[model samples]
Target chain A: MSEVQLTSDLIQWKDGAADWEEAIRVSAAPLLQQGNIAESYIDAMVENIRTLGPYILIAPNVALPHARPEMGVSEAGIALTVFNEDVAFPAGHDNKTQTARIFICLAAVDSDSHLSLLQGISQWIDNSELLNRLLEASSKDEVKDLINQYS
Target chain B: MKILCVCGMGFGSSLMLKMTADKVIKKKGLKATVEATDIGTAGSTPVDLILTNNEFASQLKGGKSEVRAVVNVASEEEVEKAINDFLESQ
Candidate 1:
């Protein structure tokens, strides 16, 4: 798997965002700018979460956001980000919810490669310290540092 | 036997979990065919056991399975234990 660096527009959010919607807006900017994913990808995934709470909390504090590729993924790629403060996805399995400080947005060209990337990313999220670093990173360089360390 | 790994957007952790399942099962000398799919396509196929990270499970509306378990797939021990436990139960 190859690593993609987060650029300026990608790191759109600061330390605070009132809700998940706003957060997704900022988080989706970079990938959308790169033409990796269609504009609708973010809205679709965010809508799923808004309706389902944190159903996709794959690991402890990290949540990987996604929607159907048909929703509009023109390319096979991912845009990642670390959130400063913990954000909640309200309802989820077990009363157990997620802080969701890290976001891995996946856009794939086909089903098979999509699954491959998903597996790679899940393994990546398993690392607690790595997840922490993603959440704590201040700039794209720092995000790149964390990605290099793990990916 | 068949094992299905699921994930969101049909990508991400589920694919990772599929690789993990392959490695662990191979090491354990178990005979099984592992297939990973996005949850949206889950109903389109047949599976014996379903493995997935959190998000994909939610999208799995209803499908065929003797067992359906949702684990982080992030924890090796957890994955191993779940696999062992499933094997024994079967």
Candidate 2:
């Protein structure tokens, strides 16, 4: 076990997700297993996109999966799931479904706990080189190293 | 001045935008307060300006506050430009 304590099992790599909803579920799996979030939290993440549109698509090929803090979050936790292929998310711009290879699922306990993490994540999203490398990275450890370097 | 950062869920991505906006607003020495908010509750709250991504910008338009659709919420440069534009227009 290489340091799987607080931030353990928080980063993962996947071949692809069936759809946007599945992408969030896959991204949030680590958090749920680590007791950071409940089942309803995952549903809220999906429902949020469906109702509010793909506002989660913060960057070009990245989606920030999150919901209301009171949805079902035990504590503030973050998870990053990278997909080799694009996962289809609904209406990003001009009614066109946006697909992102990176899904950063977030479980925020309150309004402020996750701001620092988001700052790192959003800045990481701005790094095109890192994002490109993440899309091609082979192992979860490799991806974890890159994410840790930034966040 | 009061600024509201909008996202799907107020606490989700808006907080990040709020951080960037706060930095830029402070660096520019402007008198403004940035608050993070979700899209559902953002409409009723009147502020001087609203900073949000392209997705939520349209949804927040036509309010008392001006709306700027920021493409990159993490980029302080982009946010700084928006704030300067706001000041220039005022």
Candidate 3:
């Protein structure tokens, strides 16, 4: 398969979420509307964190929320939601909660495809300065440009 | 050395850990076979260390393998430290 670059329409900027579940819902809303993923995928993403803890926060202030493709993924895509204030996920390390300002919801066609999406996110996260800039970015185009520069 | 990157469903975060492990291990000029698997399979497979986030580490304990609860899956520094720390003890 070829590399996937996230489109600008799939990106959204928000102020904050009431909680983590809402954050996942807010992050995945674009994918659901695009028919890239089913609503069940959103529920599954939230369920994973509820059961397995906040494993999605791969880097500081960043998260890649995802579920098994078999659950409800129709197409391989990523939806990004940048929050002004960080949203917290439950049961993180040291009995404290994990929070993130950037939430990238991943929908892979199969088990094998998530790695590609993972590869893309890894580059953006590898540079903490870029990630911090992402949080500071003023517009969706800026966010897309920054991500495009790396992934 | 064999390293198993185990997660709840072996789909999301485990893959990231596997990627970092593969890169860090290769950079260190070490020979190792690393795989990402679900929790059920991880318990049955024998490996030197079972690497995962801190939350899943407790459930993966009491088994044959030693569990290292990693704080950051995408950090090369964290992963390299985990790998070197594990290799030195062996």
Candidate 4:
């Protein structure tokens, strides 16, 4: 799938919420509202952060938070976010070190699709230049444009 | 062939790896079934191979099937490479 197929307007972030939970909540809230995910799914994902720390902080500026599809997923897509300010996952070794400005929460039907999407995402995250550009993105249009370039 | 991919929660990363595997396998014209299992249910799945990331691969119980640890938690290339490496060795 192309970047357009993977993202939507819901993934954009406007405010820089100080609390990491709030940042995640803001990023994923829209998808939840549109019935893309069960309400509990959002809670489960946020709880992972609270409990496991920022283990999903896979790279320098990006964080991917997701739960099982069984939690709630009717479709296959990705929710994107750009945090206005850095937010920290306290307990991680990268604790306070890896603050994500870009968040991509994936929702898929099963393991196979989830894996493919994550792999697509990994290809984007693995690129140092693209990641930096994602962080620097000031608007949703810019973010989408950047992702379009890569995806 | 049946492939079982496991992770800590069988939720996020594990599922992602499974998707990539299925895609690659399908692309290569291999008929296979792939599922993601958490470490909790790894014993229940009937799979010929196990694909997992860094820390999670180490947790599997000794069994008759083969196991591979893909380099990154989420790299299709790594997963493909691992599978190719396994196939070559076999």
Standalone chain B TM-score for every prediction: 0.78, 0.94, 0.93, 0.85
Clashes of 3: 0
Assign candidate 1 its CAPRI class: acceptable
Instruction: Report the C-alpha displacement of residue B46, candidate 3, in angstroms.
Output: 2.5
Give Cα distance to truth, residue B84, candidate 3, Å. Answer: 0.6
Q: Which digits, one per residue and each the tens of the lDDT, describe model 2 over residues A40-139?
A: 9999888877787889877778788888777888977788888988898777546766688888887777655566667667678668788888888887
Rank the candidate models, highest DockQ first.
2, 3, 1, 4
A77-128 per-residue lDDT for model 3 (tens digits): 9888899898988865458777899998889888775678777777667788
User: Which 10 residues in a row give candidate 3 chain B its minimum summed lDDT?
Assistant: B53-62
> Which residue pairs of candidate 1 clash?
A56-B55, A118-B12, A118-B13, A119-B12, A119-B15, A119-B16, B10-B38
lDDT of 2: 0.80
- DockQ values, each candidate: 0.43, 0.64, 0.59, 0.16
Evaluated with lDDT, which candidate comes out highest? 3
lDDT of model 3 at residue B65?
92
Better of 1 and 3 by DockQ: 3
| lDDT (C-alpha) at residue B73 in model 3 | 79
Global lDDT scores for all candidate models: 0.68, 0.80, 0.83, 0.70
What is the CAPRI rating of model 4's predicted complex?
A: incorrect
Candidate 2 residue pairs in backbone clash: B10-B37, B10-B38
Which candidate has the highest TM-score of all?
A: 3
lDDT of 4 at A117: 67
Cα lDDT tens digits, model 1, B1-90, are 888877654455666677778887888888998886765677678777778755445455355664445556667666677678777887
